[model samples]
Structure formats: structure tokens, C-alpha cells
Target: MTRDITIVGAGWAGLAAAVKATQLGLKVHLFDAANAPGGRAKSVAHQGQLFDNGQHALIGAYSETLGLIQTMDLQPQALFERQAMKWQYPRGECYALPQDAYPLKALRSLLFSKRFSVREKSTLLKPLFFSVSQALWGKTDDTVAHLFQGVSPKIMRDIISPLCLSALNTPVSVASANIFMRVLKDAFANPPQSCEFLFPRLPLSDIFPLPCLNWLRERGARIQLNHRIDDLQDLDPHVPAILAVPPWQASLLTHDKYPQWSMLAKHIKHRAIASIYVKGLRAESDSKQAPSSSYPGSLMCLNDHDESEDCVHPQFGLQRDVNASTRNSHPEGAEHWALIVSAADPNARQTIIENALKAACEQLKLSDVQLELCTVEKRATFSCDAHLQRPPCWIDSGLMAAGDYVQGPYPGTLEGAVRSGFQAVTQLVDASFVSSHAGNTSRVL
Candidate 1:
């Protein structure tokens, strides 16, 4: 059980740490509670179809993620679709968010698209104008909303808010300006092609974790699945263990040799994501039409007027049954479509899913859609709330923590998780080198 490095959790962060540690010639033991890898990003099977737990998309600016993908040598195109994305809204209204999916094509669409008023389009340019300056020099106390409020009418409510909420998983009003600026810099400052948004064509686990697993195995890293750490013990003085387990789990382990670091533990919050997958009998009539295509899934916020209180599931995008086009009718007489709704609060999920299903039906014009199978998944992940209790990247001597909960500008995102792992590995490698050098110098003296 003695390992130079022991990584808990086989999610992207843990996997990333293993990959990097193995590269540094360090022996790593990777452990996870899941039977397989990919944590939240994994896939699930239902009846005959394979569906992802949620829809995940990455932008060209995700250099680190893309680099990891390359390192695994997985065909990016096989798993992901790197192309221009369509920003859809109600009334069948759609606009192309400016990036390299097709820069010239998007520009032409923006100029003529009726998605915004001419005045709003002019306002949209406000971000482009200030994006460079902000990116280069960095932003101030200006929150994303504050900085872009008056720039463009369309930009504020439509573009900025939606984009910010989607990326940060928080409302635009409170989303950080620095993080928002980093997004702008990645898009506008980097090559247009580099900004191409990437969405996995396959399930997320296939896209996120499987590749890392294969890569780690080839690199000689040991992966332990279904092996949850019950407790941490025997931390001899000056020996530190990375407590990368969940905060709740960490609290249970507080009686261990090291409880002082557990103070940063209370700041962590548990957030739940509830997803309802509905499979219904497809009508024989619609069999000629394509089954799955996403609409810009939109829901009206309930409470906040500034759209702050409304639990607008920006990521609540849609998935229509692609099988509808080919088959005249479901053999089982069930129409199929996947509705995924995630929220921090479980009580609110019921309302969110009911309203979302209604909106999805109206948008897809499938009012007669009957639910054959409705499955709900709760306890999706920990909340990545702003100002939460987050510990530093490096904790005690020879020990470190890396997960979505660690110090980062963003919340519990794949990017945040991976970044934490990357940073943790960096600290571990650097510290080890320094330790070795110091010991050698002392012996010589």
C-alpha cells in the first residue's frame, strides 16, 4: 500500500494527476469509488440506447483539455464535433456565437441574423472593442455583468449572461470578471480556429476518462476502482497524505492523524443534479424526420427579475430522438427524447424538469410525447459556489489536494478539476526535487 503518490478519485482530476506523475517517473496509485472511470462524465445504458448523463461541450480555448486529449492520442474528431455552434433561442430564433466554427460564416450570419436589433448588434461590438484591452491588461472590480452592462443591449442579456452562466455554472450577475475576460481572451485573442467549440459526439466518459485510463495503463500507473478510502491513518510526523476525498467524506476522516487541515473542509458544499431521461413511443408519421437535434433550450426564470433568481438551465439544452426519422413507429410504442436538468437544489429540480419538459415538447412540437421511461439521477456533484471554503493547492508536506473544489477562478467544472490536478502534480514534482536537493546538500556538509 505504500506509494510515492496516491491519487484518490479517478475523475478527470485524479486521472490527470496520475498521467503527469507517471511522466515524472513517480509511482502512482489511482483509486476511485466508481466501478469504472469518468466519474460524472461517464455514460449510462438504458434499454437499447446509450446516452450521456449530460451534454458537455468545450471551446477551442480549452488548450489544456485538448492537449490532454492529444496526449492520449484519441481521435478528437471521433469523440467530438469541432464546428460552428448555433445559439438557439425561443421562436426558433438562432444566432452563431462568434468564434472559428466558421468565422466568416458566423460574421455574415451575425450581420444579417434577426436574432438582435441593429442597435443591439452595435452594442455587441462593445465587447470586441474592449475585450483586447481587458484581456491584455486584465479586468478590475468589474464583474462580467458590470463590465458589459451598457456595452450592447444584445450582448448583456443574450450573449454575455447566457455564456457566463453556461461556463461558470453561476448567474451572470455574480460571475467573476477575471474569468469572463479569460474567456474573451481565449476566443478573440487566440486563433479563430483555436476558438472552435468542441462537443463530444460520444458519451462524456468515452471522451473524458477512458482515454486517460488507457494512457495511464500504458504508462504503468495502477488504477484501483470500487475501492473507496474508508479512513486515513498513520501519517507519521512530517509525512503528509493528500486528502483529495469529498469534503463530507473528509469530515468523517477528521479523527485521523491530521485534522487541522480539515478546517478548509467546512467551506465545501454539496450540490445535487437531477436528470430525467424520458423515452416514449415514436409516432409512425414522424419516422421520416430526423430524431435528435438540439434547440437552444430556454426556460423562464421564476424569481429574480434581472434573471438572477430564475433557475435558467442554460446547459439544459435539448436532445430530440434521432431514431424518429427512420422508424415508422416504436416497436414498443414509445417516442424517445432525453431531457437532462441539473440544479444545485433537489426540491427545485421537480419544478425545473416539469417546466423544461413542457418547453422541450413545445419547442420540438412533440406535445403528444408520452413518457415510457423516466429516470432521475440525483447527487450529481458538489457545488462549485463562489466564496466557498477552498484549501490551497498544496496542503501538508508531501501531500496535496486536487479536485474541482480546490483554489481556482472557476467552480466545479471539468476544467477546474483538471487544472487542480495539473497544479497539484506541479507542486508535488517541484517539492520532491527540492527535498532531494536539500538532503544531498546536507549530507555533503
Candidate 2:
């Protein structure tokens, strides 16, 4: 029997497509090489602890991603902070961007914050006064560095660069000026809290993928696991197959289908990330007067090295040294803090972890704590490079491709992945309607 749809790769993109398509009343078949779902966000159990292969945080601007999560009926509180992000600089000075709608609050915070130089603060506010002409015009034909020309190197190095790299997973220089602009637009457009930072509290498998997987099974969607299709020819002669695989892998399949896929395939680029996970018997949050789930400086740029101190700021999530001891198992003195660090460059994985651990200890003043466990994960993701080729939703008659790699305005993020899947399913539905109409006409003939 011809299934209504066959989606390749059970990653976030594929799984999202499966759920959405199935809900649309199409029979869905999802194929993946991984034993589980969530792809890069998958989780693994280390001893008694369940740790995600990497860390993922959701922003309030990510409405589509959050909508999907909400649709799955997962408890939002379990998966996200749903509050304003709290940032701590290396000097122990702290800032809370606040989770509220007042732009004035953000403006005030910038004014009083000691983190930025007078010049830096002015450069940051330049966005507010940017010519309404240029604002409407969006990104100029300049690099990110060009965008921040007069800003202090400190602001760029410590703040903007880290935020950009974490979101786009590319260095500021390499990231598209337009992409970075979108990030700014979202932050400023929403109520300050609308941009709340949300990371998965449970393992990623459970947070994002497992619920969808279970739903697919209950709905009788055919899910094939541990099967890697190295070649497109390996797929059955099924029309409407969605090739929701990665870029390098997609490149191989597109070589023969240039007439069909060359344009889309060329727009996709891969960036790599490494995640270092450390176990804490106590939650790092307990140590602070106000516990924080994420720290902005944890994921710093490759070049932002200050050797005077051994530890770097925890930019993305936790800030602590790799050598710091896990706290006790409760707030009294315990709760494990899992320090997860990520960077686009694969080579600097070790050094980043070392520096991160060092910084965590220095900032927390926990040099005397006992160590628990440290593990590193490389190949976190393929950089979603700008100007790469993207394949179409439908290809080779019965075959289609989906995933973040499919055509989209944004890079390969959770939103992009979901959008791609939604697009492929739409294409399939349209094509099916046309095919059915033609068949009925043939009978009349």
C-alpha cells in the first residue's frame, strides 16, 4: 500500500512533519538512523543521571517552536523558564533583562548596567535611533562587525558575539547581517519577557521528541529506526518521499537529481558544535541567592580569552569551572549543576570546556568542591551557513525532502526544522490532490 507520506530522518524536523502531517489525515512513515528521536537534542543516561547530549534553550520569540511544544500537551513549566533571562558577567556583576513588556525597562537596564561602556551603551542603543529608513531597509550590505563599528570591543566580545554565535552557531563575522538583524527584531519587537529563555528541564528526548514519537506510534505511523540511507536510490520507488536529512548527506543524494534539487541543496551549509556536560550532585542554582538556569556568557566566542582567570563566564547556561565540585544533593548544600557548553568550531571543544569549568569555579568561588563527572559531545550540529543550496519539498515525482535544510528564511533551528516539515507535507498534499484529479479524468476518458 502506498503510504500518504514517507519522511526521512526522525530528527526534530522529520518528527514535527510526521505529527503535523498525520494530524492532517495522511499516513506518515518516518525513517531515522538514530534509535531515538530529537537528533542533536537527544539525551543519554550517565550512571543515574539523565543528561542531554547538548543543551537547547527556547526563546519567547520562538512562537512556532513553543506552539508545537504546547500542542504536544507537554507541561511548559517543566521545559522552560518562561521568565526573563538573567545574565552574569565575569566580574560578578549581574543583570536581569526582565520578563515584561516594557521597552523602557530594557532601555533603563542598559543605561544603568555597568557591563557596557558609555560608548558600548551608545552603540547598543543605535538600533533604537537607526534611521527608520534603514530600519525598514533591514540589514545593510555589511558584516556584523561593520554593524557595530564604533562599539567597544568589550561589548562585542563579551555580549553580542556570544549571543550571535549561540543562536546562529556561527561567528559574528561569518553570520549573515540579515540573520542577526532578525534576532534583534524579535527581541525588541516582543514585550521584554516575550523573549524569555527556556531550556528543556527533562532530557531532550522527553522534552521534544518522545511525545511526538509516541503519538506517531499510537496513530499507526510507520517509524523505521537505526536505518541510514547513504544513497537516495536506496529508497523505495515511492512518490512523495521527504528527504529530511542533513546537508552533507543531502549533497550526496542531490548529485544525480541536479535538475530537481540543485538550487535548494546549494543554499545549505553545515556548522559543527561541541557540548561538554559535567555532573553536579547539587544544582548550581542553589549556590546563588537567586538560582538561575541559564547564564549568558557560558557560550563565549573562540577568541574572547582572558588568561588572567582560568574560568570563562557561563554564557548560555551555567557558569562554573570544570574542576568545581558538584554541590550536595539539595538546596542545603546540594543539587547537581550540569555545565553544558557549546561552540560552532569543533576543534576548540576541549579548550572551551576547560575554560568554562575554570570560570565556573572562579565565579562561584567553589574551588574546594569535589568533582563528579565530565563528558564532551562533538558534532553538535552542522552550521546553517548562509547562501547554501536548499532542496525543494517535492523531488523526482514521488520523492520530496524536508527538515531545516529545506528552503526557509532562517537557519536550521527548531523553528526552521518545523517549518520545513510543514512545507514538505503541504507540497505532498497538493501533489496528491492533483494526482487524484488526473486519475479521475483518465477514467472518464
Candidate 3:
């Protein structure tokens, strides 16, 4: 039989699967309920200015994602501004990894960072080395907080906590240590440049999904936008289908035919990510001035004490300076910035945005600021806890699953999503090939 694949959802995972399937000589049909392609990572235009759903950051470790972008002929250099990894805190402490070279730069930075005392630096480095070495053997499947039992409280609050929330979208106290270690290993254990940061210059949609769609369309793949699949049974049984929607949506789509999978999907918990886009801020005249309370780093972590019952201390992104050129090209006049809050409370979204804006104004020395937009993704990512049980890629021979929430080494990230998509399509192709060969042999006999 001729190989064909039907993908439900036009998000990163679905797009990845479709692209891979098409490359493998399989006819592909991709569907999405949205008018556009990108799901959570898409862009929206407000008053002639573009803003993403959230501030999505990327690193060199996103190999699959980079490869997919390359496959689509989308230049990563054009889409993103690559820089050295810098973890700056609002309190004026910074731990920056060198952009020039890997392990050497990392070691040098750790040893020479002015932010930590000798003892504090040693305390931080020892655990990281231990964790990396332990990862080689086998990591403990415990919470991150539990894993770093003897680490200093200062390191936990300043470094580990922020990194955990940003990476896993889960608090260190509850996030899976094994997964966290894997992320760290991938990030730091590789070549020196692997630690470099890639900030999207364009909107998330423009960077991947839209370009991917165009590429797929050019390759004769049928893509249907604003198309919702209400019933999985409606799809052709001869052609394998990949469900790349969120867990809840997947549960709804597969509840009848795949009851067990539906149950597993339903059991998966999720976390929220909130981004507050503020306008009417003035750009800093002097870029070289020392970091101040009213002028924090362009990207800085908030202290725990700054958090409230309804709001977590967000990682602020001052796009005012960075987007100055873009703003000049566009009709929008005001300076814009984004504050990303992970695991945000939906009920207190307004309060969270308000608090974040207030904090930004006070810290960044902004005299006048107006809220442009506030986007909250309530089910942004699965709760990456130690005990979380994600659904597998191969749901059945005819039906497969692909999404960030599916079983993977890393947490629910863009890399995880893309990797899952490729994995699902590969599994489908392999199964089909095997089945075809077996049937041909039986017929000959």
C-alpha cells in the first residue's frame, strides 16, 4: 500500500511530523483549528505592533529544532540574535557563560564570577559536577529541590529556582531532577558554543510555523487551517494519523477509540505561562551605565520576596532597546517590553500583569508605561514533576501521538515537541514497512 500520513494540529510537533513524512516520500495532510499555524508560540498583531504569546527562549541544544528550520530553508541567523548565555538577577548579580568557547569558558566564568564568594562559587560548582557525573551513572528520579539537598540557599534562590521555572515550568521543589540534569548535560556538556542563547528577532510564528507551512505547501502537502477534527474515526484508517494536539484536546479526540490513551492524557497536569507586553516606555540613553534598581539588566530574574500569592517573580525582557530599529520601521511609536511569568495563576492574571508592570517601571526607571497586551497560556506545558506519566509516541499501529507532552528525555520544550514529531513519523513509517513486508511474504507463501 502507498504510504500516507494525516496529522491533526499544525503546531510545531504536527509541522515537524508532516515535514519528516513528506521527506520520507509519504503523502501528508496537516490540519489545525487556528487560522494560522503556530499554536502557543504564534504571534498576534496589536495596534500595528507584533507580540508573541510568551517570551520563548532558545539555546544551542535545540538541535532538532535547528535542523527543522534549516530543512525549511529558514535561516536561524536571520531569525534570532545569538549571544552568550547570561543569567542576570535584579539584585545586580550575574553569571554569564562565555560565548567564545565551552567547558573552558564555563569553568573560567564559574571561578571568576564576582557575584559569588569563593565558598559560594565552590558550593555551586561542586553540586553541578556531582550532578553531571551522577547523570553518567544514573540520575535520581527525585524533585530538583530534593536532588540539591546540601546546596546553599543563596544558589537555590538565585540560580536553580529561576532556571528550574524557566526550563521545566515547574518549581524546583517539585520538578523532576533527572530531567533537569539531562537538560543541563545537553546544554553544558557539549561544545562551548552550545551554551549560546538564541533570542528570536522575529515573532515566533514568523520564525518557524509560517515558514514551515510555506515549505510544506511547496512540497505538495495539503494543509488545512481553521479545520478542527471532531472525531478521529472520521479519518481514513489505511493512512496512519498523528495526533499532535495538547493532552486535553488529544483526550477529547481519542476518548472513544483509544480509551486508555485518553485516560492517560486526561491525567496529565499542566502549567501556565503569562506574558505582559507593556508600551510607552522610554529607551535608556546610556547603555553602559551600571545596573541600578531603576535600571536592571535587559533580562533579569526577580527575587523570591518580590513574588506575591497570585504572582511569581517573572523574568523580565526589556525589548525597548532591542526593538528600537523594528519600531522605527513600523508605525507603532511606543517602546515595548515583555515580562514572562511561568506557572502563572489564571484567576489573578490581571493582578500578575499589573504587579509585573509596576515592578518593571520601578526597576527600569520608566516614567510612563501603558499595558499593550497580556497573554496567558493556562496549559502552556505539562507539569514536569518526578511522578508525571506522559503518553508514549506509538499509541497504535494506525494512530500515533506527537507533542511536547509525549514521552521524552527533556521537558515540554520546542526541542521536545520537534523531536517527538520526528519520532512519531519514523515509528509510523517503520511499522508500515514491516507490515507491508510481512504481508508480501505471506502472499508469496
**Per-prediction count of colliding residue pairs?**
15, 51, 2
Candidate 2 weakest lDDT stretch, 10 residues = 436-445
* Residue 386 Cα positional deviation in candidate 1, in Å, after optimal superposition: 5.7
* Best model per TM-score: 3
Residues 121-193 of candidate 3: C-alpha lDDT, one tens digit per residue? 6766656776767768875588888888777777677777777888898888788988887887788767554
Cα lDDT, model 3, residue 78: 77
Go through the candidates in order and give each one's C-alpha lDDT. Answer: 0.58, 0.60, 0.76
Full ranking by TM-score: 3, 2, 1
Q: Which of candidates 2 and 3 is the stronger one according to TM-score?
A: 3
lDDT per residue (tens digit) for residues 108-174 in model 2: 7767788676777877655455534466765454456556666677767666677666677666665
Clashes of 2: 51
TM-score of 3: 0.90
lDDT of 1 by residue, 1-445 (tens): 1235777778777877777666656666777877888766676665665656654567776777777777788867766666555555544356655543443454466678776778877765666666667757765645566667676644455656666655665556665666666655555445565556675656677676887888888878778899887765533333334555655665566546456656676556554544545544435665444233432222221111134433523234444333432223454544445554434345665565665566445544454655433433344444444334576776666677777777776566677777778788777656552122222221110
Better of 2 and 3 by lDDT: 3
TM-score on alpha carbons, each prediction: 0.76, 0.81, 0.90
Candidate 3 yields a Cα-based lDDT of 0.76
